[model samples]
Target: MDIHYRNEPPQFDGANLQMHFIAEVDGEPLDCAITAEALEDHFGAQSALEGPLREAFQRGQTLIRAVCTRAIEQGAGPVVLHSGRFRSPDVPDVLH
Candidate 1:
């Protein structure tokens, strides 16, 4: 199983960042929120990531990976975030 997402530009909030995103698994909508703080816990010091959107999208990818990991750990079967031509399932590669 794989998941794909389309994320909006992140909304910054003090020490946190939130990305509004939409995802689909088996082609069904799965609305989710990707936050920088959460990513920091999982990834650490995202503020050092250089650009704003770049960091935001990176957090989005971390969110996707976390979800997949949780599913797999629960014996939910193999899952991955489909990749195509360097495309990001959670957020756009370029800054918006």
Candidate 2:
């Protein structure tokens, strides 16, 4: 099963930044239990989440986080942060 994440920007409440996201399994959204981490804004993009959809975004973030955390923890092997390996079409993994 493949899970995809759709994010709706970060919601800043003057003091905190709330990241809202959705988890879709096979293109369908599923309600999930999640954990939240307050990250430092190294990029300095201080835009806040507002309007009628703000509350919904916040809830979505929680759901997505929970789903991801649970799934990753259940997987085997060590959890490593930032391998820094990104797929670049311009640069092939193997040189011909």
Candidate 3:
């Protein structure tokens, strides 16, 4: 239920944006997610304004990984992490 930021002042440019989350249970890494965001805001929002969103994503990933890892680590079974793009169900078909 705790989150940690491995990097501060995360790069805004698509080239340097790297985000990672480590899920740990009983102090052991179980699952993790690594992702990068390449889009930019046109509203000229300050960097500080984006921290919460980035952090939240990272934290959520971490927690998910932790839960999955914990289950496997405790001899429940293996853990698999899947990665893919997400789209809103309401989006127009043209975008697909």
Candidate 4:
């Protein structure tokens, strides 16, 4: 899985921050977008959602939470986060 911050030079004018998360498993790709504020709520303002991301990383699930957390801390302002699963061949049947 790869986490990247989109919209070069994240804006911090109180606007929503956008992040892109890409997950690949067995050559299949899963992409998702999420925001900063949502990340802040989930992982606090000083830390990333590494736990959730790790969970996804281990379970082969498409995770965007960590990417969003970084985007927000990098200056992406208050954000409205959104996420979903994409095409993934190695995703486990049940996510722990």
Candidate 5:
């Protein structure tokens, strides 16, 4: 699958309390999000506020995109990456 990520900034989805981003799979855009909890747990996000969350997302974008790409390849419709997903041994510690 040709998975390409958009360069757009992640948007805070207050309704779902997650940061949303876009990835194109073979020219089709897929909805993807990372939970605030995940940011806090793995990316050193001190709070759910946009600034901290965005900083955390920037630090962890590589792994986050990898995880999202894996999920999409596995046939997930809309990828929502949570804190627990990052706990896998194969997932790298990409905090900066």
Candidate 6:
């Protein structure tokens, strides 16, 4: 499956405490999100506030996309990236 990420800006979902972004898998749009906890733990986010979370999302977007791709390839739907996902040994330390 081919994954193409959109150039759209991520939006902060205060209710969910996550940042939502869009992607396309084989031309079909897919919803994806990364939790605030993941951003704080791995992306150098100082706080869960909008500004910091957005900055962190931008800074770590490439790695985030890669993770999303892996998840999609594994048959995940509407990817929801959490802190626990990054705690696995397979994920790189550079994100920490």
Top candidate, metric lDDT: 6
Give the local distance difference test score of model 5.
0.90
TM-score of candidate 4 against the unseen true structure: 0.30
Residues forming the 10-long window of minimal summed lDDT in candidate 5: 87-96
- The parts of candidate 6 lying over 4 Å away from their true place are none
Query: On residues 5-65, what C-alpha lDDT tens digit does candidate 4 reach at each position?
Result: 3322222323334434543323444344444443444323333344443333233312344
In candidate 5, residue 51 scores what lDDT? 93
Model 5, 21-82: lDDT tens per residue?
A: 99999999988999999999998999999899999999989889998888888899689999
- Candidate 2 residue lDDT tens string, 1-96: 666556545433433334433456667664332112222121122233344234433544443344354454465112211112112232233411
lDDT of 1 by residue, 1-96 (tens): 556555554334344354435555666655444454444443443562336534645645654545644544455443323322123343333411
Stretches of model 1 off by over 4 angstroms after superposition: 7-17, 45-56, 59-63, 66-96
Q: Clashes in each model (backbone N, CA, C under 3 Å)?
A: 0, 2, 0, 0, 0, 0
TM-score of 1: 0.39
Q: How much lDDT does candidate 6 score? A: 0.92
84: Cα error in model 4, Å: 12
lDDT measured at residue 63 in model 4 versus the true structure, 0 to 100: 37
Candidate with top TM-score is 6
Model 2 C-alpha RMSD to native: 10.2
Compute each candidate's TM-score over C-alphas: 0.39, 0.29, 0.27, 0.30, 0.92, 0.94
What C-alpha lDDT do the candidate models reach, one value each? 0.45, 0.36, 0.36, 0.37, 0.90, 0.92
Candidate 2 C-alpha error for residue 58, in Å? 16
Candidate 3 clashing pairs, residues 3+ apart or interchain: none
Model 3 C-alpha lDDT per residue in residues 1-96, reported as the tens digit of each score: 432334333333234343334444455554343233211121122342346436544444434344444444456433332222223343234324
